[model samples]
Target: MSISEQEVRHVAHLARLQLTEAQLRQMTGQLDTILSYVDKLSELDTEGVAPTTHALAASNAFREDRVAPSLPRQEALANAPQHNDESFIVPRVI
Candidate 1:
């Protein structure tokens, strides 16, 4: 699971990253360690476990949707900076 210098260079090229020699060497070791640790986790047996969205049990906690009265047209348009007969007026765009 160790990443080589050449592999690190290839990855950098794909990601459009420009890493210094020191950074590339450092990242290669770090990424190799992380992948090796993940490889260890892959050895666990969990054939019968159900997939879950969260570690703890969860349920929807939604409020009921309801319709309510709306403001009158005059009240809704009272603070408009500019307006035409029945609609707000706005500057023209090309």
Candidate 2:
């Protein structure tokens, strides 16, 4: 499939992009090349292949979760430049 200059212009407008004539031409060619490559990929034979999210097998390497004592609040706030009774007092952000 090929993308036209008009279609590229429409897409640029939708994306709030200000493309010059030269840029529009370049983008149209790039999009055409990308679509052509995708079309070629669609011609591959994979009748029984399962769809996969990634090319390589991946799994989370999780450690055993155990309850641990947390740092005391006073110790955690010891280095704070400014603080109230329970929390840090940073400058107000509108």
Best prediction by TM-score: 2
Candidate 1: Cα lDDT at 20? 99
| lDDT tens per residue, model 2, 1-94 | 8889999999999999999989999899999999999999999998999999989999989988999999888987899999885998899999
**Full-model lDDT, candidate 1:** 0.90
lDDT of 1 by residue, 4-70 (tens): 9899889999999999999999989988999999999989998999988899997899979989898
Query: Model 1 residue 45 lDDT?
Result: 96
Q: Please give the TM-score that candidate 2 achieves against the real structure.
A: 0.71
Question: Lowest summed lDDT over 10 consecutive residues: which window, candidate 1?
Answer: 82-91
TM-score of each: 0.59, 0.71
| Residue 91 in candidate 1, Cα distance off native in Å | 15
lDDT of 1 at 14: 100
Clash count (model 2, backbone only): 0
